[model samples]
Target: MVAGLVLGDAWLWVAVEWSPPAYAPFYARGGFDALTATLLVAALVKAALLWLILRAPAPGPLDRRAKALRRLLYLAVAYNLVLWYAFALLPDAVDAAFQLALWTGIDVLYLLVIRWRSRMLRAAAGAMLAVELAGMVNELLDELDLRELGSGGVVGLGLTLGGVAATVITVVGQRRDGRWSRGTQAAGWLSAIVCALAIPLDILFGRISSGSLAFPVMIDAVGLVITVWHAATARELPAEGRPAELPPARQRVIRVAVAAAAVLPIIALIQPEQTPHLTYTGWSMDCYDRPSFGDLKPEERDAAFLCRARSTEGGVPPVFPDSLSDQQILAYGRALCRTEDRDERKTILTRAGSARPAWGVDPWDLVYVCPEIIGATYPELLRSTKETEAANAAYIAEKNARCRDPWPRTKGVVQASANYFLFVDGDTGYLVHDPGDEAADEVAEQATDKVYDDSALIGVAGSAVLIGHFEDVVDLCLTVKAFRTPPPQRTAGWDEVNEVPIVSRSGRLTVPEMGEGGDVGAGAPMPNLAIAGKGRYRLRVHVRVDDAGEEQHLVVVYPGASRKRLRLKP
Candidate 1:
């Protein structure tokens, strides 16, 4: 009856773990999906302990006969546990801690066997038991009310029963008894060997060899038949005295084995490093496969990304918080994009984000992690709805009216260097618009620095002495904008608004026609300064972009450099 019960539970574990009921809301929610696999391994370990008890002579100084076998079983279980957790992906705290505890306890128990007569073994054994109990309790709490129970047993029930069996049987195996203890010992050791050998085959070859977990399951089936034999035979091995100590050379080998076990995992963690996982509060976006990232719609992008990021054979990418739907993912993506503070931009956040300095938002992963989802999805968001379109359109027109000239059309995004803010302020690129009709970089160097930041979102259009000493190349669109009685400022909605003093030696000058190339030129292939003849004119240059700024800054030119850079709007 006992053998049959063990056989049934073993089948339950393999069946449920291999094909988890992921349709259930709580299934695979955390590490819960692999609960059955953990249980299966536990059952095999327990069976090993049973075999050790039933088929061996009474314990005395941890027999030399199976010492090597014990070490092999331990190594196998350790490897299998590591892989199982890897398969689980985002294991919770309890799952990780429990596995660690189980590993430590098994090692400690093995150590006890090697030097069983050592007075220190008693304390080490107690410590192992304590660690196991704590692990059991931690797991029990994690699964409380989370996992539902039925025939196979899972979550709290499976783990709890395994814990109980480990505690009770392990205690039973410690005794020096007659016939019964011998059979229990034999059963226990055999079960461990079965598990040590079978699980890895199941994981490594099960699917490829038989297209299922037939490898491990069959090994388990063979284990059950042996159990039946053990039950019927009822062995009576005689108790024996403590065996002689293992040779010093053999002991040295055992110590080296233990040291290798400890060093291997640390090396693995060090090489490429362990991949970290993030548990999102709501949405899960991890898929990155796409033809063109920016082209896909937000929903489609989200449909592509999510789940601490793992590949599935078919269907949707596994949602991290699995309850999320396609539409909800979109809604969540929108919410994240729209989360720009109505009050302030993420300036401090940039400072706090990463130690590496950057002019853009790459260090902080609000959108860079998933481009399709929240990154490019909201580019046209201001005009997405009819009301938003009308309101944003009117607002843009009102802002642009400040610029006196037609909005300069930007050709493309120009890569800015580390001193981009310096260029934005007019130190490098503008002074005398050389009537020779080139932006005279030589003359612009004489202009004073007048860069100041207001941290304002939408500031008024308007600046002076906007010397254009640009690095042999300046995008005309950035230099000129719709300047009203004041000029239009292009803040790009998120970029900082800065103004600095600019001086022009003469009004009649030329600026480069900057484009997507590495060509060298001084000004716009060149624009008429329209500046009623430039001589000793003060210019406060505002380099900014708004959502509707058409990717161009509103360069408002005024007369006379300010004592300092001025804030154009409240």
Candidate 2:
């Protein structure tokens, strides 16, 4: 009877876990319809097998064992189906924990039903009972309040030791118990073996991971086979004056109960895995309402990109609190794009540009406004920004260090265009460069001995601020990008540029962090005066360094330069 019950449960677990239909409302909603149908069909097959087992002959009216077996079979069937259904409805992590608990519950019940038999079986059952109860308790405790008995912990270690001990004792006891049938002795030993194997398998596969189903079901199947073999061939024991059958009326009640147990689970199988009327809340709804993420929808892809951008902060990518839907995420991206304070422009462009052709969203869709600056979908653009910023940062660091030390002068000619030129030494500092063009009509000058003082430079459309540092007469120059006209006003054909002198000086300029796109310091890659463009023009800056006893003064030489061209296009 115990064997049949364990076998039935084993069958229940295999049927439900192998390829059972998914319940509704999973990440892929209704994705398990076919599998759900498969589970229903499997249930029908198991029900038929149970009927066959019931027809097998029994000796000496073993009513107690028979009753226990039927109840176990009913519980197994109901719980397996309920667990799968619940797993589909719950989050994956939550469902996994619940299934593990259910597995433990079923195992405990099995031990309780069969523990009264042999001394060896009782010992094995007691050990298992302790393990299961302890596991449950540990799971309920908080990590800070009390350490959980994880697979590697003391409680799990103890269970493993206990399982081994039980297996050894069972085998030794069976060898000594000469009067018991070999089959019965073997049965006790085999059950102990299953108990011993359970600890390692649980540890290896994890308590609720998918593969965990393999060992427990295997143990139950082995138990079932042994039970069937014992029932088929073993000699009958003394009747002990127990009635061969229950009283006639009581017999009828037993029959009814058995039939109901067999039939109820089969009926329960017909419940729909998910209902159309089901309502979800919080993250569940988020997943449910998400539009399909397929290559056909460019807007949806952009939305996904936007969602990733907005969700990420301070270099961390956004986590899926719950999987967001296509439409919902796209709506979020669209709303963000409309905001003026939005600083994800480079991030959007780079991510879009790097996307492969297989991805439906066109990079052009995100950066059509500034084609030249943004670079239309070139993957190289992604690394170019970083390389440029790194170069700038190294240049600033080196020049500042040089001014502090007044190091030996090293000169190298660096190329400069009308817009930007910086003397960059991988070893030294970075400086913005512009040689004096004789055509300029006005010149402004400043002299400062203290650090962090400003030098003003006049341009056609606007003026720029330059901060200088003096270390015992040596000078350092820093240019701050001045944006007098907003981005909207500065477009193609608009001639405006701020020129700084080409000289060896140590000065630092702060640019926005890369991909952050926010205001300076909010993120990297913020616009600097050096990055701005204008028509061909030049300005000459001369610096005279003189030493005081303990301090230094830097006098700026603003030689007249030209605004020969009205505009330069970038």
Candidate 3:
């Protein structure tokens, strides 16, 4: 009984933990509370039933009437066991309803024919045997994947199979000797064998934790020991004598005790939990205990999810391939995002010194796909200030010698002005049309068309002369760039140094319109005199209109990083 109590409590704990979300309503309504209460009641009831069996004098060899009575006893016990298993293991409400109805209906039939004991026993035995066989077959079909057997079916199958074995063994023992003592020995052996087999199979199946099975197994084993003890002490009677019944007072006491046991479980079922959330019988603790992410505190759950997002394998562009595992990607991504290296920032810039798609991909993509590359391309990012600057020199040289050219470079832009904008990539000049002005649109079209007409300008492969709204088109250029010339200098006003605003967010150079009277000195040459070859320069200079209706030079020279010392003009 002590062993039974411990096992039962453990099983109840596990069942509550593994209970599914769908069973939340039931839990709120005290379904699990009822199950726990009933398991205790069942232990008590079974002990009393066994004591009654043991105390009765052994009946003489069975006449048809005695055989029928023994069969009825087996069926009644089997029916109860099957229902108990159903309630314990099945998560679905429908399955529980079916099993409950079956159990109650059988009991009702048994009561109807109670006066005609032989007929009632025969009828009940047939019904229970048929039920057990059907359940066994269903389980077999489901295990083979030929049918969909749910949680209820699984528990019902195990219980019925074990009950059938016990019943058959008892019947055989009774046939050999009419003594009820022999039947107790049969029960003991059957219980031992069934429970031993059941534990291993439950583990192999991987439904719930194997440890949880120990409770049910131990309880059955305890019952088996009790049966064996009773069998050893029982005495057989004369052939003509009937089995002895309990005294009236003892019978009345047993009846009252049984009633109390039944009532307790029913009351437990009706009583609702005070504070209920959705937690119920459907949750599986074993799932949370898996190797990669087990035993996580509530706070650690978000970290686990972050790890998953960075671990995507092949996609439309293969965001992050399976070449990297989730843990590796997550660790590297976090490292790069926290990096503080200036050179690491430049590694994201295009050969033209424009930062757009970082290293041929987005910054987010870098963190996910090739974090090691970010570290490799900019080693200073991961090092402390005291580390030698040349520490990565050899590694960089070795890698550059063998690494394939990271090609298909792309560039993007940001613009400050709402009017016109212009960008020159290689020999191709992109013009942004001010959609609100018909004259500006014509000028943009003419400028774009001139790119193809001029022979000196070497057109970059697949570079089309683009013309669209300043904000909608040229403002956000994510397309691949042909690495040729450095991107044009950008500024807010006249005074500045070489500033690297994130190129994706920095404005394209603003192109102001020419005055009504066009003439020499009408356009100003931006004074960053460094030119690429003899290609015809597609200038997009800002021109200031004077009162005379003539556009004059609006020269602006924003400063940049240079090694040479400059002579200051006084």
Local distance difference test, per candidate? 0.37, 0.35, 0.36
Off by over 4 Å in 3: 1-47, 57-129, 137-248, 263-570
Cα-lDDT of candidate 3: 0.36
Which should have the higher lDDT, number 2 or number 3?
Answer: 3
Poorly placed runs, candidate 1 (over 4 Å): 1-116, 145-211, 219-570
Stretches of model 2 off by over 4 angstroms after superposition: 1-57, 63-124, 136-570
- TM-score top scorer: 2
What's the count of clashing pairs in each model shown? 85, 23, 11
The residue-by-residue lDDT of candidate 2 on 324-439, one tens digit each, is: 44344344345334433424533443343322222223333333222243343353333335564675566545644433312113211111111111223211112222212231
Tens-digit lDDT track of model 1 for 58-158? 34343553344354444434334235545366446555555655555454544444324445545555554555465445554455544423334344344
Q: Candidate 1 or 2, higher lDDT? A: 1
Instruction: Supply the TM-score for candidate 3.
Output: 0.24
- Candidate 3: Cα lDDT at 285: 38
* Candidate order by decreasing lDDT: 1, 3, 2
